[model samples]
Target: MDLALTAAGASVRAAAALSPRWGAAVALPLFGHVAPPRPVRVDDEPTMWRARRGRLRIPGIDRRGTEVETYEWGSGGRTVVLAHGWDARASQFAPLVRELVAEGHRVVAFDAPAHGASVGRRTYLVDWLDIFSALQERFGSFEAVVGHSFGGLAALVGVAGGIGAQRVVTVAAPADADALLTQFQAGLGYSDAVSVRMRELFASRYFPGERDPFAWLSSVRRPIPAAVPLLIVHDRGDRLVPFAEAERIAAAHPGARILETSGLGHNRILAADVVLDAVLEHIAAPIAAPAAESSAQVADREVVAAA
Candidate 1:
């Protein structure tokens, strides 16, 4: 049981009983908060040792100096940019980074604010976009931009917003920003009144002066250009971000290739052998001949042969 979640649940319920506006105001910050950053795992060590570490100062919400940790592996090859999910660091991409480097592709990844070695307690969706833009300015054009979970949505938004990349891969990612609010409401067992107020607060605070902020950030609403090849890797049994979200993403992009897996759940899907193969194949393929003329769904064990 999560003591913090439980306490938050009680607090929000109490506040909502008083006033939903107050409840939403209280819950907004919790929605942005991440758990403690994960340490480098045993499997991540080998890749970690091979990386050339660096830092980029991405201004925080209040315009304070906040430095995000960056990592690079291999050089003098097609550069592939990687973006990690919320609460996850760049090192989470160690397996994918290793394979890309072995294929002679330069790999770049960054730990978003409030994650990994970065110094912060809370981060918003716009912060992820800012980091991606900063990396693109430094790296120029990317051969591919692969993102996981929240990072996946950011990658799509960034590409749509003009970060050049020939190919894009999204693993176990949500379809839009609204999903974040929905999940937060469900997790804290808040009421619809609170949910409505939270939406108002989120939009006003995160994306001020925008008529339709969620649509602006939605992959379904503003998909990557049809010219760019897309690969959607997801697990059918994922509990964090539902498989339905991946389906919505695939439905939005006609020619997107889908690698549907089971049992790997959310985060573990990142290191799955099959998922890596699909991502690599997508990256190596010619942009002219997308993945499929239409969305193609292949099961985990058969993805390699299908690809």
Candidate 2:
């Protein structure tokens, strides 16, 4: 993985050095890399197998062409929805889902378009928004929504766009489109000129009326209702997303509370006990405690046996 990323970085730098215009052309696919389907086969958690699964067709430019896979872990109760980051599938939430289920709240998580088992090769911000919209219609307003990285940004955008989740949690997520572009460039070693053109291409291609890609992401800064609470959590040591992004997000939404972690890093934040406990406290949609705990333990043993 390191070698491949290094090669990609070298290629972008070389292309940018030759011609700024052609450099942007080369970077176009990198932007598209954001939406590409990824291969993921990690299935260590047992909770994944115990859940009920369903699929919903996404309404895209081509009606009924895209579909997303959904997983339901518990029955009727205040629900907490989960959204995974780019290149991640829904099952990545197994640990957090089990905790939520143990606490007695229903948990629903879905594979975003082009990720996991969902159909299609491309996904975008709209795909995230639309999936949350569909889930909201079916589950009504969620007790809370937990999203990591790109997924975190989506939840905030969804809230702004009227997909209701009473409580919000964003972990290691970027604050704006510009922040994302800057990080991508820094990692891939793309020139500032190339990043600018890539943004232009993105704006022209997906957002016709908008000239800047950041405009589409402006919803992250839109005013959220005072009634809804948001929590912004990030690890200072994370290499993928800077902690400053979380600060900016918290600053943008005055109602948001900020939490910082130490060595857990980006993806590891999802697995930390402290993070799970913090999330449970914010949502406070507990199930019948002792019974729920026993059932959750049984489910875990079943999962291990099945594995």
Candidate 3:
């Protein structure tokens, strides 16, 4: 009887440990982290036909050795590279592209790997950085970079790594990879241990032999690169990415500007008037002349004064 009681207790403990709630908590975040199926629409052909730009094929950054498709609009001179977000196609930036071109700026846009016409099964951070590098080599340095959502994160990483750009604008960008990953995990009910493990797995698989990518955000302190100026924009009502993430990015980068507006959530913020105006303002600002790395200091002072 004693042996049977002991066996029963052990079984109960095991069952409790494997409860549905626990499983859901761990598995949910992992599952949520997986990219969702891109919606298929019938208008792809029509959209392509209407596109005023031509497509260019370039070798992908990943070892997959696939050719990625990049599209471009407008003629040369003071080029602006517009990078779209996760699960988004380059066509999504069409409105902005038209406006920029009308304002006498050339626009270059690309379909990031695994998105739109780009060739890939999946894409990671390195893929983004690689694409940016390729663009810099092929299309020349950009006067400004405008990115939406995940593209915004990629822009930050690219600019920090010295992709020559005078100004950068991110729309609804998450502050950093960790915070974004945490939110993704929480959405799926993942336990802290599982979340950490998954992050490690991602880091190992996506960035082997490389240091933590999130750390790159903090390394922009002094001796700030003269080529990169950052403008961060977020919607206060964004449910996909919290506004705090923008604030965090602003706090980390010396002269980073944060613009918070109401009504435009994650998706719609791209088209919001306030966001468009702010982007134009940032881009039209005079290019910083070569100085003793004091622009960051001056920008910080201006931000503080405005606040």
Candidate 4:
């Protein structure tokens, strides 16, 4: 465990000793906190420098003005939106941006509120939906929506919720938000009592009217339509989100194609040549014909599992 998580766990435990509600009250904000944003890698520099930079003023958790950094590249072929993972920046999709632009795609990407160059301290799942909604109004229907990790979840949710897209891709993303909260609870070594209250508070605080926040934020329960080709790429050895999540997603979306990789773990899989190739191919493929509306498997599948 890292020093920061260790210290946080200790603090939460102490608060739980006083009262589980107290621990939950303390833990909720930390759970939503977005900080120490990852720096733009040296590899991301070239693509970052080439982007047509812009900004979007979207309402945030506090219903105040928030600026979200946006980037665009290429023109005219087809527009693709790249959604980076949590605590990650738009520039992290540099390699994919280059590839898409090379194929004559007008690529659109953004750093969510509280992430990258965007200005905010806390964010939630709904923020992604809001950003996607805002972008759709500007860019019109997307040719494809590609997302990684939490952003991937947002993409699935967005497309499932009727943000038009012919193709959808999710990389190393969990199937739902509830699993992430469970992982966070485990990592913090908090008790079940604290977890229950924490979830209750989280839903009330973030999504007031929602009867079930977890289900509302789920990708599996509300999957992208079968008509839209969905590609799911996940590392078999990923330590953060287990490969089973990929299987679950694939199982839920009958016609989805799933690619399993080795060694790349969580983040590095983004730049893997195989991953990029698969994404490009999936993007370029014609929308699924009636016959193609079945689980179309791809790449090396050691398990021979139905996608």
Best by TM-score: 4
Q: How do the residues 1-307 of candidate 4 rate in per-residue lDDT, one tens digit apiece? A: 6898899999999999999999998899899888777888987998998999998878887777687899999998488999988888898889899999999999999999889888888897778888888988898899999999999898988898889888999999999988889999999999999999999999989888889978858876887777888889999889988998888788778767888888888998888888888999999998746554445543233222112
Model 3: lDDT equals: 0.66
Q: Rank the candidates by TM-score, best first.
A: 4, 1, 2, 3
TM-score of each: 0.93, 0.83, 0.77, 0.94
Per-model CA lDDT versus the true structure:
0.86, 0.75, 0.66, 0.86
- Residue 242 miss distance in model 4 (angstroms): 1.2
**Runs with alpha carbons beyond 4 Å of true place in candidate 4:** 290-307
Worst 10 residues of 2 by lDDT: 298-307
Sorted by lDDT (best first), the order is: 4, 1, 2, 3
Query: What would the per-residue lDDT of candidate 3 be over residues 1-307, giving only the tens digit for each residue?
Result: 3463344334433433566344434442232232443553453444444455544444454464665667666677688998888778777776676678778887888777767766565665566777778878877888898988888887887887788888888888876677666765554444565555666655655566767745764323322264567788887788888877777667666566677777767876776666676788899988776546443453332211111
User: Which residues of candidate 2, in runs, are more than 4 Å off?
Assistant: 14-18, 34-44, 60-64, 211-213, 285-307
Give the alpha carbon lDDT tens digit for every residue of 1-307 in model 1. 5899999998998999999999998898888888889998988988987889999987766567688888999997599999999989888899999889889999999888889988888987788888887887888889999999999999988898888898999999999988878888888999999999999998888788988798878998998987887889888889999989998888788777888888888998888888888889989986675343444543222333212
Writing each residue's lDDT as its tens digit, candidate 2 over 144-256 gives 88999999988887887688777888888888777777777777887778887777877776566775547548534564554567777788888888877876776666545
